[model samples]
Target chain A: MLSSNPIKKSLNWLGRQLFNQENPAAFFDPLVTPINPLWIRGFTPAQVQDIITETADTKTFVLKPSNRWSGFEAGQHVNLSVDIDGVRYTRTFSLSSTPARWAEDGTITLTIKRLPGGLVTNWMHDNLKAGTVLGLSKAFGDFLVPTSVEPLLFIAGGSGITPILSLLETLEKDHYRAPVALLYFVRTQADVIGAERLYALRQRWPAFNLQVVHSQEDSKPVYLGEQHLDTIPGIKARLCYLCGPKGLMDLASDLLGKYGISDDRIRVTFFSAPAPVFTGESGGLVTFSRSGKEVEADDGKALLELAETAKLNPKYGCRMGICHQCKCTKTSGTVVNSLTGKVSSPGEEQIQLCISVPQGPVTIEL
Target chain B: MIKLTNEQLDALAKDLDAIRDEALADLGERDAKYIRKILRLHRTLEVGGRVMMPFGFIPPVFVAAVASLGLAKILENMEIGHNVMHGQYDWMNDPALNSQTYEWDTVCTSDSWRRTHNYEHHTYTNIIGKDRDYGYAVLRLSDDQKWHPAHSLQFINYILLTVFFQWGVGLHELETEKLRSREIRLRDKLPLIKEFFQKGGRQAFKDYVFFPLLTLPVAPIVLLGNAGANLIRNLWASTVIFCGHFTEQAETFTEEECEGESKGHWYLRQISGSSNFTGGLWVHILSGHLSHQIEHHVFPDIPAHRYREMAPKVQAICEKYGITYNTGSFGRQYMTVLRKIAHYSLPDRVRLKLQAA
Candidate 1:
């Protein structure tokens, strides 16, 4: 999007192509930007495991659909592109793996529940299997584990744990000796995705505490108010990391502020695309000098998001980057990473931008 | 020109529901009878070693076909929903068409939608103040008229806002418009309120909240397949719709012009509003029948199935009446529309944020 005229032209051309052909790969033109455009060729159902007991309708599928070699970020998703009869279609999904996880294995574990009137996801539950090849695109998001940020707090709800799981993996890799806490909310005990894993992680590292709160469950009535996550405890101090449905994240955020958590301490990842924040130029050159990416981020998205949308392939994690995969050395001017968070370092030439809002011609090193 | 009255609207709603039911029932009967032949064909294919997959998922070769089916189903729903909802309102004179039956079906008809979608949206487009889809400070679609200080000289702010908050803005605009409309009494609109409350009320409050929340976040497979089917059909049909309106060469009249135009001028305006795509095959299957946006804009009441036979006639009449007749290749026109929408957003990409102080 930063590179307007050409990107717009390309998108226009691709949009036209999509009109003619269902799930056209033309729309997934990676050459449009330096980023690796997520290409969904096809997929095979990998594993189906039950997550929650709500009708057991929600099952997580470890998909290895035909054709596609999954390339994803922890919080990014794949668009299931399928064609039925003669019509073609595409749907977006948030990936549950970090790039490292995806690079090693071409498997995307999609935590799916039967949607009431959903199109592709509904078909996935009813018909998909090991050999069932569904259309899939490569990793198309910037959400992943932030690298080595202090006192990281991960707050999640329901099946929203997929991205957080990837973050947990990255945190383990960086081996940061900071206190990392996870507050996962679900309807019941069964809804917690990696409760045992986190428990083990908690046991291994006293700095890491795993707390699971179920709003609907009578037995473990932790975090009683289903309406507001702000009602939780110890939300301040820690650099908050959030991945779940929007409402939960919003509630977490609203509560964080209420409990005296500054906007600087909190980060949220929406289940769908979050609103656009100015990442500097409304339409101009965006140079991530260290990453060798100098392009126009004109399409009206966050510079990071534009980078992702145009497939810039920049290194970013936890899109909120409380983890700091989106951390960059701000060699020149300032960049707004988040709509609210700001970290000013005039001398060191570095900043974390999932919270750094963009202004003008800015340079960053990965 | 028939004046649109509330009684007429109610009557129209009833009639549209009846048309939908009758058409759906007829289509169902036809499908049942035709399905035997289709089954026979499938059986023949099966015997001949053709690959026939199950209802839900299938192999790769069929992926495109499956997507197409999904697109088709979606289009059929939209077409049936939209066309039966509006296009048939003029057919109240036909005694064969029944209204009482369809008025009460689930997926209640949106009178508000009729106002926004039928009356204003398509008619007003992106003319900011006039079109209720006005997005404030943060930019939404280029057509949203407001210019906030943050967006002045900061198009990325505008674009990001548009892409991210586009859906919300759309939904909000409808809700905002409906809320402000003063037409629907608060008590009578309670059913809708109740429906939304029942559907959207306790999203995380009630355990059932997961049902609708999961509708998108956790989309159900069966419903998705059906919706996929519906979406496929809709895509195919929507292609025609998007192409028809959003195509290139369609003049986007300014708010002053659009609002100021006379009824005759408005009639001519809608004529010049959209374009017709080319190719005899396209003319035959898509342009010829399934949709006639070009003709519909000129004479919205005329049935689309009658477009192919009537298009030349309509064009000739426009020529005689000194009204411009717009037509082009579908691909060409659609590309034009995209370019225009994109173009419209670029003019003030960087609005000056300060005075020369």
Candidate 2:
């Protein structure tokens, strides 16, 4: 038994070569496709094991991915592809489950907050269910906890508690020696996500502290301010982690700066891009030259969104302005970049379809 | 068809563009589902057909197996592979469905086809000297083409082309005409020739060697069945493609005529240069949705399944603009194409006006 088993290894290789000739990932398909075997190939497929309602507008999706899924880091994000009405939509979400949990149960969780009038999120909330198959990209992003054992402060707002939850659970499981405090803000008490888990963590870890702020319940909105920072002892020395809406994160950053908390000590993750300003003149025809298709442009919407509405599938990676994957040639007319608030000169120029809204009649070489 | 002024033609182009936009906007789950289902069915049929080929000891089994395999190849080459490789489903963001990355199960490399068909044929359409696909360098499709002594043998050439259509498509990018004229140096042709051989060798090995050899004692039967299947697929593909592009009603434009072409002129050229055939869903799929050739010429990147829904809308726009939408039954279209090919083989003056009428 102690000797190297050459025969076993050879047989394993032979078996793999014979069965996995067409697809290397076919073995994993059987594992996850017990309920639905008709999974899309050439993509990492995962089955929705369960859906847990975290709040009124938020739900945590538990996924059991194929064996091809390499384990993800605690604070990493993964791109998920879901098909709604036969059209596939991709969105990135931070994995909220600990690596230990994934190792033990082979499951991960993504807490999604439904955005009103949003395409993917609304479709997911309304239609996604147990046994539904989804495509997943390998884990990415570098928002991990530092090696230092300095006391930690985690500030989470609304649905921003996802990655923080992962970090806390990992720390608690590892028996972290440092003191940790969490300030979770939501509109009301009912809006709190993972309340029971946070309570359990507080009971188990002696140095762990939890503060659930119900902002809407009070006569005046209870925004995190200097007063909140003063309550946490030695807050200036703590390694601060912030994940929240842009407005809340901005306020916290200002306060933390005033408190003399160093820049390196603060880590922030944005769940979504800030809402784009819709100042471009619309109600003009947007023509796709190659497809010979034209649609009336609605005021203040990015060309990518308009393309989607027109049922012309334009390639895009990150919906935010950062990714240049959605760049297209504007053959004529001006387009305003919603992210930078810069207007393009009329005539031929490359514009990011995801960020550029039509100023007037536009023709795009899509 | 009523003659129209330049301004009226421009209005027609605008109306046709509007139709395309409306068609795109109307695309929904049904359109996506159609292609997805066809892909699955094609795959299933291919597997089933291949599996049944070894049992060709039974005469009925041999015919059924060959027919099934032939149909599978047709569907794959036309409905699934060709459409997918056109960047039709690129918006789906499924890497498997991406046009740039899709490799079809044919001798022709996807890269070469994309350049030859997607860029050259589609961009130039039926322009006499510009579009290689007008006669595929072997036939005199229009009177605009200089009549040659070699074109007298076009009747036989057309038959041979149909028999080996896939190989013709495979070697299309080689531009053998240029090679004959020494327009391309041998060094320039090296990479393309290497790619062609690589793809051709792989296809031959699979169809003629690997699968046939796997059948052992029934190897001959399997090999013959495979050959028969390929022949059927080739003939059908040739018929569908030829009918779409070379019918009597289809016109060829000169480079001078197409120069300084506005959007309206482009639309006019596409309408006159392409012919459509009326068919059911199965027929449409078998034709690779080339039945709606006019719509396809206008919108090459849109999913081919949407062409059926778009055809009537485009026709209505054409009617409003007094532009002729050249469409007919499958038999009518094929006969017309064959008649045109025969009629155009002779010198222009010698051709009968009665036949032209």
Candidate 3:
């Protein structure tokens, strides 16, 4: 505590020297301070969990503690939160495995079926080995299953079977045994998920009818592969839920709208995102239908660029499959097979033209 | 991918050659007027018969006059003369004219300049990716463009100049780039010093460099005259370009929009995007009539001279399709663009809120 002025001065000089050495010109900006982590509102898979495969490409990931006790009434969904790289991201999956699973094991099960580039599903495939601890949020979504006793019709395309499967499970468990019709579309015999479980479900319940529409080169006429939906009978009284891509949903909308059904009665879940963009070789011409202009797009290019060349204001958003905001209706003609020689057939109704190419000529309702 | 069809290719080649021939014809006419004058001066300067003068005024007198007129005034006069000329290819149509190679070495024409000047330079002004006109972002020669590393200091210089001289910075920067262009050489350059009655920069450089340098002299008299001419011209032009682009009307391309291959949307974007300054002929020509930015962006191959004729056609097309055509008088749109620039360049949150509607 005595006066050691020179020593103190020497220490101060050293401190200044150190500071200057660390920062030249004292111009270093540490940038704004990062905010605290957001306790995310999306759903999470239970940490003490296991994915028991109910069928091929289908598994029930049991989340412990049921995240939320009662926000969902059956058809609602919980957005699964996952840490993608360093950034936390979330994806919504319908609660298809039923709330009853929570009674036995304090777990809410998500019957996830694999789809292309599905972030959470792909992440689960890669990292979710058994007994891995994870975080989850309580259920948070507004889509609720109807409690009405009307004939419930579910028209599912490919992996669109998830929510319907959950609804059926809930109906059977709750003793709501209402008459139901399901027309499930699959690419091949191998594409059907939860088929065995569904087969048992049909055998136990006489009121449930199941139709499998397959897309294959050779199939029986009575089998009626991927034929028109208008041929399906007794749709007048059924309360319908359509789930698939925008094209599939449009078909559902148009066909069902014909029967004088109000749009509110039909709940549609277009596949999580839009379809894959048609990739191609370099340099093909793009003819803007109404603009009287032709612009060039090279291979692996999106058709939206052609509008830029012609000076058109096309409405848009994330061109990636995420937003699905740029979905345009393809009026007629085929889009060039960006990869193989097959055009994107989104049903007979529409195509997300952003992901489609020009074949011969094409017109769009821009 | 952008290859021309065989017939179009042949037409393009022939057109290129014809343009060359036309430029030569114009040069031939200029040589006829200036060739004898140069010869007479050379002869007079050599021996005592007559006092030979290569230029109308001595180098010092010319410099003094230019200094009084100032760099801004000289630029204004040049800009006016250039505007009046307006890609003048009258010489090409003239039967009496010969090509520059055969006829003259002194004079140049607008048609020839179009290849080097308009086609290559102006068409690519300040484009960041392919074109090299990456001028400073601050006191811009063009509009808000992608920043260039080389221009950082130059932009600082521009602002400092402006702080003292108002638009002195802009005029100097533009004229300097214009004068020192590659088109000048020693043969054309050496005589300018004698014209200005000074000796450092030869005439072609003087025309290219020193003639423009006349705009930047330090003297008060020179600076004053330069101010009057440039302020008017700069205001006229800056108003035109800034209004056409900087307005609330114009929008930046999203990554989706930028990369989309759809020509219709691009057309719609340009149609909906750019603002047009409407009305008047004198202001139009002086401002380079760029309010038709949408048309120019859509069909860059078309000449500026043809734009006036094409404006209505373009407008009609937009109208038929129910496309919104944005047009406003000079002052109205110019302030709009200024406000837009200020608004957009703010923090992202502010810009996002403003743009969401």
Candidate 4:
């Protein structure tokens, strides 16, 4: 029976107030001790439970998030906010663990591939360890399996297999009785992330086919060509999900198009953009009006990255321009939208700082 | 004195921007340590004050306890609460210091304060019809504000506002002006009114009823002590806040002047509309670093201690631009603010004539 007694409710409120349970961490955080994860609210606090080295430059961080974190879908992404040297940085990554794992163990995994000179990724790989606490935004993303039971083809390269691994695990848990094949491309056998798990899945499920393509092992530069599509039965009928480096994904897309597959049958998630080319007009001055801070901003980097480099902590959510938390006033000068390749006029306007690059001398109210 | 051209203004803005950027870059262990230390001191003072309150049989002890408690409340509201709510220490990633989540030890709710203070006041500082903080919908502070007969007794209104400043802040989110003009329906204000009463009730209960009831043998002394402490805190907050933005040199703007405003112009307004007071480290913290009002206005999200460091740089830019940097000792600034409030109480034509005289 529901307790609708006013006396009980009043006592509960009194208890919360007395204990500061609404935000218990605020009372204890002044001691500089580790905050109990259960007390964290608003931004879900997660403790690093373990770090599994997947490859030489790749790691899967197992996180135990507080109760405030709602479970995520099998193929969704979450924004991880970490503080390094007193500066907080937020980066979005796919949750590589299945929802079932989260339900059973109350934990999630983020498989991160360290890029050369990458700030957050390198910091996590080197500095993050068990017992370190970080902030996490609730899971959000549209990339997921269709409701219809169509035959699946997942083409992944490098670290792009993280989300697919989650989908495969979910499929296995559900006992999905559909033909599914994964074409995972890596530099060599040692570079294959989650190879053992894929092999085990292939042995357990008859309909599941795992292909680990070693690009460097083949002298002729192994690439996804039309010849690879012929190997898959009913290639045109399969729903192809592509996630990888631009080169491999583009090749696979072209091959899929020639096979007369409908555009609706193809789904692609871009892990990273190719390195931006710096032209003569790339470098410019960015003025943060409020802070009285200005920096010489070079092209090829987003304004959010520049702001971080300048040590101006701006609020951000999904760094991919989906969450508009980093939107600030662009008071003067022009900036190019990195996502849309559009130039903003010099005037007062709101621009998403995450995806904006200064075209010339720019002034923003950060 | 020379008038600044748009180009000159932009340059001044850039110079000021450089200082802020440098300070932000310089923020590290020391700045974090400073805030944490202040927080610890505030907590210690509060606990000490509360514990000593029941021993009011001794007059000196009672006075000291009240003073300690008042100072603690002042520090919590100004240096810690206000600045943290401004996202000054958000980089620390400490939930306690988060601008979006930190609830102050005042009657006002943090969410309401964020909307009214952080968003409205910071965005539209000293703009006549825009910034509700222009006399906080009570007394007139500028000639742009049309005078009403009720303002004739603005001296009394000012005193009332000071005494009940926390309650006034609690009710600020309701935007009583909009309700008065019928721009906001009574129904729309219901939720805010409810929130105000709930928060106000909790505060009143804690200070007047709960704590006093606990000290049943000396309930009257406890109640009076709490009231006295609250009164002291409110008065100090009101004075510090008023001196910052309602001084003789603080300028108010029109909506037209603010239209399509550039970053440089925004900075210009913030500096011109904020007055500062000369003070030591303790005085600055007690004032919630509002003694560096110009710097605080310019970089609302920068930690308060950084404002003290940035003040001279900011003042130099003001001097270079031939702009008046309104600053004086606390007594002088507070008196000037009161005089300005009184000057605006009369009709605009009368005030203009007085100004000319």
Candidate 5:
């Protein structure tokens, strides 16, 4: 609607001409940014209003996004970016608070758990405070509650309980009378995030069944099995939503398939990109997604050279990797960074084409 | 001409590489804060100037408006635009400061700049017929270029070039000389020509049309102020850049001699091809730290602000290798540049032996 409006369109064109920028806000952002970091354009800026320690390694960050931010659905995820040691790093996290909460108080929460070597999550835990501002992308994820008020089953592990908490809160607010069961998995009771809120919801909502399953009870870990699936009421009829580590998700999908639940009925969400195992070999069928061209790369040359050799003139500068002018999206396959010698995960990632050498077959959006 | 042996060149390379690494390692909060402060200052001046434009009927106010706008343009073009486009602060990961996508307030598109200045120029720095930036394919700086009767007025041409420096830089990628020689077809250059017009047209509209028209009865004064501001920025930017590389002591290299060059030899070439000038903090900032052009040539991707700390170490390495570290006061260096332009304007047969700079 805004795009079709003639006055707004002409104003946008005039702004572009006058400012020599993408928009007027960008041209003026630097002037007012020091007064309030939220004055920034392009990305939505959010201020940390509060922080709650959920576990030893996990914390819930309560953020108040600027009014320009379009709110999200209850069970969606957003990418949070933080500046660490002057370099910006980003990581994805599920919104732990419901949309109604944001509408009422202009605030949302993201529950994060620290990864062993994770740069962003660790920085958030150690450095982020009540007044720190961070960059946020709009919420995105298909892990949403079904509108049909049918029996629903939720399976969450570790920090994966985040989106599920938002879904549960929304369901209760809407007073949905349909049956619901949540099998929340954690290593131990101390590690259970939002423990009090889960128990509170179980007591207040009659149809909500909350099961806190401790996998590592008394140091003898008991994993998910058929007994857990068989005990859930109406397992065949209820639609399933899963969020967890890859191992748990695969196991759950396998058990649900065996129980006659179709693949379409079982939806799952992965919190982070799965790390790829490298064979330490060279040569891959490099696909340029845009051009639909395939190149058989044999030697251990950077992708930029290979692209140019195939007569594809991808934008590049400082061919040795210093200038990020050559950075492009590698949609799939692992690559080793020549400068830092770090292996990349086999998923979509921004990489400097001048430094990235494919470990095997890799696809890039040139 | 450089006389360093292979062993000496290797040691020089090691020393320069160590200096670059040390500066890069020290880049963190301090570097980020410094750049952000400059960005804020630039924005403040620009906003203040625009706000004052409507009241330009007053003589003092008009002068202040022009000066404010000029300083802002200089800061943006040199300190922020030039250095950021060099990929100096790519580690910051700020979208506005990103080298790949940042569009400066100038007429030249960032894409064209990245190709011409970053890739072609910086990579092949000062190698005749390779780095077009040697004299921007215009004035003949070194004797390597063939002398022509047209070069007789290159002294006057240099003055005109400085006054309209931004336009000259914006049109540098068109390879106008190649176009004249019919080496590149006009049909092939249609897309580039369109890009230049679009970018340059927007800049003209902004400074010449939009802002002036918005000021109603004070339109003429506002227009004059904007033109004056652009002139100041162009002259300042041109002078600072000329001092960086055009000093008499700077050497020119042959592309054939650079074939299969080792890392040490590459380092030697960079030092020989560039010159530096001494200045205080404000001068350094106004020049975008390009006054330390020798250190910048060694590590172009490193943050420009760090060049001050890196210069002494680079000079020490040059001294150790018996290399001439070309540096002098700003006035002295700029004088040598003017002398070189005048001296080179004549045929080599009639040229006088100027004292070593």
Candidate 6:
């Protein structure tokens, strides 16, 4: 975009000469970041304006992004980069605040659920504080409200309520009078995220209805079924938005499908990558071309781990798929992306060693 | 020199490995912050030098500009570029510091440096025929090397190497020795030569052409200032590197002796072949912490800044193992390097002494 503008392009060229090929904005980052951490280039910088505990294991980060940051749609997700123990780790989270909030006051919020062994999420809960700077990617995702003004059915499980909360608020701000019902599934009432905000929205909006289902209730744990869908009025007519764990999404989609609801009428968003499928016959010999080392790869282990086990010190960082630090040229291979479950063609391609599982005999440039 | 028992060598290896592991485990925000601080300092000096170069009509300004610029280049090549390219701070995940892709502000490309320095020199160490870094295939610094007729003027060759140190380093991967012996054809060097020219050309254009042209009327002043800075950086780098590897006490091993070397024996070879110089914090930083060359040789991929703290532990381990840990003041080590250079300029020292008797 900077290059698209002639004046900026010329200035960039001049800056390259003055700063030994580094652009002026990036070259001055050391001086600028000390004054204002948000003044960095390449990525939008945000300051943690506040940290609010939503539940025992979930926290909400109120972020004030730099003015250079473009606002996000209500249900869009953003990749947030935080430097923990000197290593920069990036993890994506859905924006749980209304776009109107960001437009009015340059602040957005990401509600994160801490998993038992989640690296970045646990680090954020334990160490991140107000005033710490973070790198942010532009918002992306299509889990947005459809253009039509039909009645809406929202089914969210646990932290999946994050994006749903943003959509509900945005719909309320737009004064949508259509009937809207939310079936929020949580382990318990205390596990609810943004409970007060949801209650407040329901109190203000007459067309909205909220239901809390305790899936882990001692007396009777409730799971989504035909009985639940039958209770909502005009369920088949209303467009449904589903955001939750994989099992919940699969169940909800199946039930909706049986109810004569077309796939076009259902929107599903996954909060995390699905587990990559690996059969017993999946793995094969992996050849590191540079080192001339041949290793037998296990079914589901990433190339990076295999390299390390074979005494090859492949360059890596953030041992997760978020950082492309361990990407290498796959000269020949059929590999599967652990994050997206996408299979690569058996030819030359670049793949992230951290996330790719070799499907067959492969050769890679180490 | 003391001959370490195999058992003692194993214990020594364990001790040094423990030191390396301890330092590695302790790597975190401190190492990242240290590198960032050095980078900032380097950029500040570079920017300051470039800005002051046009005002070089004032003699003092000219000197100050050159000094700052030279220090900046030294910091970039040593403390920042050299360490980063060693995969020292690879955990940082910053693209600027990524070892595989980081290109320093020098004539030598990072790729070539990784192959020639990190791989060949580090892996083979001071093995007589294996590590060209022993004498850089020029001056004979060890008695094991056969003397050539050209050995007489090696003192001059050493000086020339120092003055144009960057070029020498940039062209090292070309294997001029192999080319001379016709072991390798010039055609095989085409790719390397192309890389050298592209990287070297860009470096030349930046300091000599672009910056000078930008300053127009004061072009010559800017040009001269840049050249002066480069000369200073070359001289400083060459002197520090020579002291680290060519001091009198540093031993050279024949390939036969190092065959299929075990981990303990490898550690022994590294300690025997490398030297260290004691200096203050600034001196260590300016040398890219190569002042702790022994620690570096033992753990080449670990962050160089940690070498200072690891030094005493390493020395103690050496004492316990009855192995030599060659270290002294920077001046003392450098003088010994000079002495070795001068002494090796003649034929075998033992033969000369016998002739004198």
Backbone clash count, each prediction separately:
97, 0, 55, 4, 0, 0
Among all candidates shown, the one with the greatest TM-score: 5
lDDT of 5 by residue, A114-196 (tens): 87766677788998899998988989999997978899999899998999999999999999888999988899999999998
| Model 4: residue A137 alpha-carbon error in angstroms | 4.4
Q: After superposing candidate 6, which stretches have Cα over 4 Å from the reference?
A: A1-7, A10-24, A147-152, A174-179, A203-207, A234-239, A260-266, A272-296, A299-366, B1-6, B349-351, B354-357
The candidate with the higher lDDT, 4 or 6, is: 6
Q: TM-score of model 1's chain A, to 2 decimals?
A: 0.54
Q: Worst 10-residue stretch by lDDT in candidate 4 chain B?
A: B93-102
User: Per-residue CA lDDT of candidate 3, range A1-366, in tens?
Assistant: 566888777655543332211221111111110121121112223553677775467667766643434445566676565543322334567776666656556666677766575555767765666555444545655444666787777878766777777778777766666677788877777877778767888888777888877755256422222354554466777778887556567777777788777888898764553333433333445666676677765555556655655687775443432122344545444464332234542211233344556644445555
Q: Per-residue lDDT for A95-210 in model 2, tens only? A: 99999999999999999988765667778899898988898889988778778788999999998899999999999888899889999999999999988888999999998989
lDDT of 1 at B323: 55
Clashing pairs for predicted structure model 5, backbone only: none
Query: What does candidate 4's lDDT look like per residue over B1-357, in tens digits?
Result: 234678987897788778876876677778778887888788678777888998976899899889988998999999999888777876565556766556777888877887777767777888888899989998887767778878878989899999999999898878778889999888987888888887777778878988789889988888899899999999999999999899888888889988987668878988898999997878998988999989988887678888877888888888788789999999999999888878878888888899899
State which candidate has the highest DockQ.
5
3 or 5: which has the higher DockQ?
Answer: 5
Q: For candidate 2, write residues B13-35 as lDDT tens digits.
A: 67876776565556667767777
TM-score of chain B of each: 0.55, 0.96, 0.45, 0.97, 0.97, 0.97
The residue-by-residue lDDT of candidate 3 on B206-225, one tens digit each, is 23332234444433333333
Instruction: Estimate the overall C-alpha local distance difference test score of candidate 4.
Output: 0.81
TM-score pick, better of 1 and 5 = 5
TM-score of each: 0.36, 0.84, 0.33, 0.68, 0.94, 0.85
> In candidate 6 chain A, where is summed lDDT lowest over 10 consecutive residues?
A272-281
lDDT of 1 by residue, B1-357 (tens): 123344543443343334333342232223223222332332232222112123234445345434544333332233333443343322221111111111211122333334454455545543545545333323333443454344334445434433323123224323544456674456665655554433232211211222223344333433344333333443454455556655555544567655554334445555565667766643434332434666655444333444565677667656555555677766777676555445445434442221111
Candidate achieving higher DockQ, 2 or 6: 6
How much lDDT does each candidate structure score?
0.47, 0.80, 0.47, 0.81, 0.85, 0.85
Using lDDT as the measure, name the better of candidate 2 and candidate 3. Answer: 2
Write down the DockQ of candidate 1. Answer: 0.02
Per-residue lDDT of B18 in model 4 = 81
Candidate 4: residue B98 lDDT (0-100): 63
Please state the CAPRI-style docking class of candidate 1: incorrect
